[model samples]
Target: MELKFKFAIASDLHIALPETVWDHPSRFHLVEFSIPALEVVLSHLAQLNLDFLLLPGDLTQHGEPDNHMWLTARLRQLPYPVYVIPGNHDVPTVESMDCFAPYYRQFGYKNPSRLYYDCEVLPGVHLIGLNSNQFDADDGQIGWIDRVQLDWLESVLSRVSKDKLVLVMVHHNILEHMPGQASNPLSKRYMLDNADRLCQLLHQANVKLVFTGHLHVQDIAYSDRFDLYDITTGSLVSYPHPYRVLTYERDRDAERLSIESYRVEAIPEQPNLQHFSREWMGDRSHLFMLNLLTKPPLNLPSAIASNLTPHLRYFWANIADGDAEFSFPNFPTNAKKYFEAFSDRPPADNNAILRL
Candidate 1:
């Protein structure tokens, strides 16, 4: 059997037009060029004759009525099929969730329960979209796969042939992409609350690939226990803005997966953005690093954390810039050694082929 298909992934779009761009003191979203940035990517992808496109989620700035409207209209003009899921920012509240189904009615869902859907995207590929959004009493968002969706997923996967490729899509990390991703307080929110249970089921079903967003970092984390790969794409509006093109092939003789990543290096009005975005993020990394070091997994003192913040200031931007080879030789011994753990690369890094 020779199975081959081409697809593109662009996640965490944070598509904020001029009016939807809100003011926040601590916010790090560079969403001013969300539209133009997407246009640049779409313009490039439109010519590639892709089999399909996977948005995975964060399709809007804040699930704004106008923003969703803008994105839906824009996607309608595209040449290929697109499948989308909702992210935390897209469904922050229960009340705001009503608009998602109707806005993207054409994309994936078979009926009104449009938050999640399953469809046959190609001859031997099943595309499963899962909604990771749930609301708490305080109206805050959480990432979880509800029981109904899980049951539905099991039913769908049970029927798929073993030869068929299963591609899962969600808005949260399903694998630990960072050092303390699953247990660390600050990082846990970016991962699905019940990732282990979901992983067990997918692994049992021989699902090899899952597409996810919501860390705004480009990472490919494999589940040693489950034999699954969670390919997380970065945000289009953030530094080192990235998107991916994946090619998967399977035959009687071999099975292989290859990934190629590209960054939106420039926008119409933001010339030389690749150089300036790193500087902008470096300037703002102090508070973020302080919180990380003082929080769980490290628990360093505030003064010590502050002193260490500058050394690891570009740590996150580097992670977001995928294929990161991070090392800290010039820092204090303990801090340098501790931060190095997060930078370790997995065997299946980007821009390469892996035998399945």
Candidate 2:
């Protein structure tokens, strides 16, 4: 018999109520649209007849109790089951970290005491939700999957039927979405500290798909050695606010997953949300662009970095919008080539079908 299912992924919601909304002049997130944007997406999703919805993480604006409460109440009204994990922004502190699982108990956190879980979302299909938030002695949060959870995952994978379809969800990227993402100083923080270990276990179990968020880019990265795909979705609170709908099918002959992405083009207040958000990101891109120009691999001088920053104003916004093809005919050859590498390299970012 053939097996098939449909699901949606709306990641990095950053849901904030009116009173909970805050602002920073240079912040990338236009969080004021959080609630309204989510409403728009959910309303559309309600008509899709989805089997389930996966909110990979960053569910709230900043781990506010009010925001969490608001999101939980809103999700309770949805027609399909929702599964979530904790993003660094969702549980920013040690105190908030301890309450994450219980607070979201209804959404995949079956055990109030445990932060990670594996359950059969459908017959012959299993879903694993993992907690990637960890705190240091000083209580500074880091992106990591502890040894205990790794061991638990190993045990779980060992027991799941080999023929079953397994889908893994987490808040941090398990594969590199950009060039040198795992080692680049500015980008590595968005990646799992021990991604290799997790990848090894998944590869061993033949788990092929991973859903993630937090970096806020719409990119599909593949691991050649492990034969795994990391489908990372863009944030709803960022420019070109986006979400994804995926359909999976399997039979004796072959298995395939088709991906299609959508953007929230407008909201009541912002009639041209895409235009507004793209400019919003560009207006604040100077400092960020400078960091990239001055960082390790490039290490360009301050004067040169400042000169190049203005030319790359829409660089990140383009990346966030996904499947970006880049060209800088006016830039120095080395700098031009380096920046161009950030564009979609293969297999398409926003839409494609994967054969497994």
Best by lDDT: 2
Look at candidate 1 and tell me the lDDT of residue 160.
89
Give the lowest summed-lDDT range of ten residues in model 2.
94-103
CA deviation > 4 Å runs, candidate 2 = none
lDDT, candidate 2, residue 177?
Answer: 93
**If scored against the real structure, what TM-score would every candidate get?**
0.96, 0.98
Collision count of model 2: 0
Give the per-residue lDDT of model 2 (tens digit) for 1-356: 47999999999999888888888888999899998899899989998989999999999988998989989988899989999998988888877777888788889998979889988998889999999999878887788899899999999999999888999999999999999898998999999989999999999999999999999999999989999999999999998799999999998898999999999999998999999999999999999999998888988988988988988999999999889988988887878989988879777889999998
How far residue 356's Cα lies from its native spot in candidate 2, in Å, is: 1.0
| Local accuracy by lDDT, each model | 0.85, 0.92
Clashing pairs in 2: none
List, residue by residue over 304-323, the lDDT tens digit for candidate 1.
88888888879889888876
